[model samples]
Target: MSVDTATKPHDRLAEALAEDMGRVNTMIRERMASEHAPRIPEVTAHLVEAGGKRLRPMLTLGAARMCGYDGPYHVHLAATVEFIHTATLLHDDVVDESQQRRERPTANLLWDNTSSVLVGDYLFARSFQLMTETGSIRVLRILSNAAATIAEGEVLQLTAARDLATTEETYLKIVRGKTAALFSAAMEVGGVIAGQDDARVQAMFDYGDALGIAFQMVDDILDYAGSDATGKNIGDDFRERKLTLPVIKAVAKADAEERAFWQRTIEKGKQDDGDLGTALALLDKHAAIDATRAEAVAWADRAKAALAGLPDHPIRGMLIDLADYVVARLR
Candidate 1:
């Protein structure tokens, strides 16, 4: 399974799904518009045009295509997925007080929290409108549940952030809620809309679930080790006092004094000038970064394995590559 180091996997997927993705993008722009609330489009466009990979929506399109769907509803479903994703991002930026997203100033930063939240709500409503147009009850159920789960996950992360006592198990629940729920739903609805068999649909769900967890873990790892090209400054998680996987692993192996250090910086939010350096040193000493990376690779492997039961399509190959690319960033 040699990857062509020349072009990235996502680029390959985009190339393969160009027409479908084009429709999804068009629908996104059309739905995000509102004549009455002009500010909605402004705020939504600011984040939507911020060079996102559109991976979640692409997952929906790829899965539908792989399952032999030739209908137009897949486009609607893909747009639904993107709208849901954008909505979550808007709410998340406000919740996290994040200043930047996708290397651009967050909507909350450019406009205000009220605009961000309202626009996020508008997107959620638009997503439901698109979902209903498909006339699939199961699709609606799955996506609505995912939206709820995302909010629940956000709440869980809000409560769990900077808590030294947060276990990996709890961390996973939060991840599943906030991130993996949408990915799984996005994939599942694709198969469901395609009238795929139960086994194949379940495989789609599993692949999306595993891929989402791996994706979030990779992001967490990048917060510690990645360059600015990642759209994040290194140690942003540390400064934000987030209890991501690497930090959680490091805490698990911490000595008493190290535990006190985490309690002060992470829990109490009293980071000194040298605390980040010390935290990085401790993470290295405990191999937390490596351990977190191993878990991400494991999840990526699970995602690839879940695809074993699916049809042998070229999109399938891109999917395997996509799963590989999820963890290859660690290299």
Candidate 2:
């Protein structure tokens, strides 16, 4: 047997659980099918087949297996996690009015907002159905709360994303809502299903929370300094007027002229040529990217530290490496 050096740590993790992942993928395809509407599969298949890392579901599987679960329910739980994540992406694209995702046209653009939103809703409903199959009220409660938290986070961002006065504290709250909630739920459910003790479950939640914050902060920095490898457009956050951590830090330290520049370009939406370049220069002037990267690394450290109490399985090492990998793009 041979391994591809190009295979990422997450990829290796997936390979380690190929049988479970295959079941998860199969379950997802089966569950996503709509009885009356062929369009549902078409729209979903576009994004589902877009080659996301499937990291969330893998986390669920890894957490469960690391705790010594051999039951059939982990597969259902993993599928539910993936479905929830996909539904969120569909809704996020529509909400952002985004045109591209994973380098392909977003479902909202290829179809319409109505389809995307409805499909997302359908998946959300389907996710609930899958979770119920496990008969774990604890898992249901956790995932449902995460779903609500994700929505709440998005709404918070609606008010806060464009406002220049958005503080880092507020920004972190938004991140916890839209992004970290699911990650936390994804990992926590694993421990719950594996019948782990409360302490271990809390550890799982802690790991996911820190890892997710690091993941999102890395994404914020990548928006300024990404290559094609990231599959995201550089400066997308700047162009979208979303006040990520880098911009938040820079705004917190801006002089009068720089404040005015941000106001005109972001608040007023009166962007001009070289505005992105000017934004980059301001970020450099303040070393906002470096500071933001440092924060992400700190979160990564927190995530790894949370794993110390977990079982000393190979999956634990992979999960820790995953924390490192999430922030590695900054380097």
Candidate 3:
């Protein structure tokens, strides 16, 4: 397959892995079904079909193919990764009380919190069933551990919310748990299934770990930068009083007056009119956005560097391009 320069890296990857992705999608649809409860399918279908980038599952398929895995289990694993991701999003909407996701009404909003939470639970069960089918205990262990880490991360974030005392290290720990764990597991499982050596598998894990951190950092940046394309309203994170990296960085450098502003708006949740603008101004004053972008670029670089140990395949180039595309928005 040939890709044009005009095509985005992920689009190029989708083109390259078209057949595998088709199988993964088919498996996702088939596995998301419910025999007894009709609402299960209904709630799951809403978010599953909401036109997400499917980046996590794509990482699974891309890694497996890059490692020359010809088995059908990669499809199963890809679907499993996506199911876990969708499940988290379902629960997240409920926790955040978010009405919208991927520019569509959230399952919690469209149905109710009960339906969304139950459906998310069902997906988690379904993901476990799918992983077990792979008959690779290693895959199951990796995914199960990732599932636990994701939950742990969410809990940590909950406790640290709007605290102002949340450190960059704490922020990184949250990022690794909530986002990077699955990414590393997804890629590592692919290499494991392909019987790759320990070193190569670790490299795949390293790539995904870095990529996930960069992805979340970019998301935090967009929440403040106001990207029409990302469907992120400027200051959504600010409105929620979430202590994302940019805000954390600014707080680190803030003086008494700036600290008081963050305390009132974020800690006290006493946001009033024009607070968003003031917050943006503070971020600019401290160059927080630039610092955040620098961190994202560094992670993207680490992601690309990790791929150096992988096989010389077309997928490798595509994966490298994907990492570059992830941080290109910040540039």
Overall lDDT per candidate, in order of appearance: 0.90, 0.88, 0.91
| Model 1 segments more than 4 A misplaced | 1-6, 98-111
**Clash counts for the predictions, in order:** 0, 0, 0
Instruction: Return the clash pairs for model 2, or none.
Output: none
Residue range 271-300, candidate 1, lDDT tens digits: 889999999999999999999999999999
lDDT of 3 at 18: 90
Off by over 4 Å in 2: 1-7, 98-111
Query: Model 2, clash count?
Result: 0
Q: Candidates ranked by lDDT, best first?
A: 3, 1, 2
Residue 226 lDDT in candidate 3? 68
**Model 3: residues with Cα > 4 Å off, grouped in runs:** 1-6, 98-111
Q: What is the per-residue lDDT of model 2 for residues 124-178, given as tens digits with 9 covering 90 to 100?
A: 9999999889999999999999999999998999888679999999899999998
**lDDT value, residue 325 of candidate 3:** 93
Query: What C-alpha lDDT, on a 0 to 100 scale, does residue 303 get in candidate 1?
Result: 97
* Weakest lDDT window of 10 consecutive positions for candidate 3: 99-108
TM-score for each prediction?
0.94, 0.94, 0.94
lDDT measured at residue 135 in model 3 versus the true structure, 0 to 100 = 94
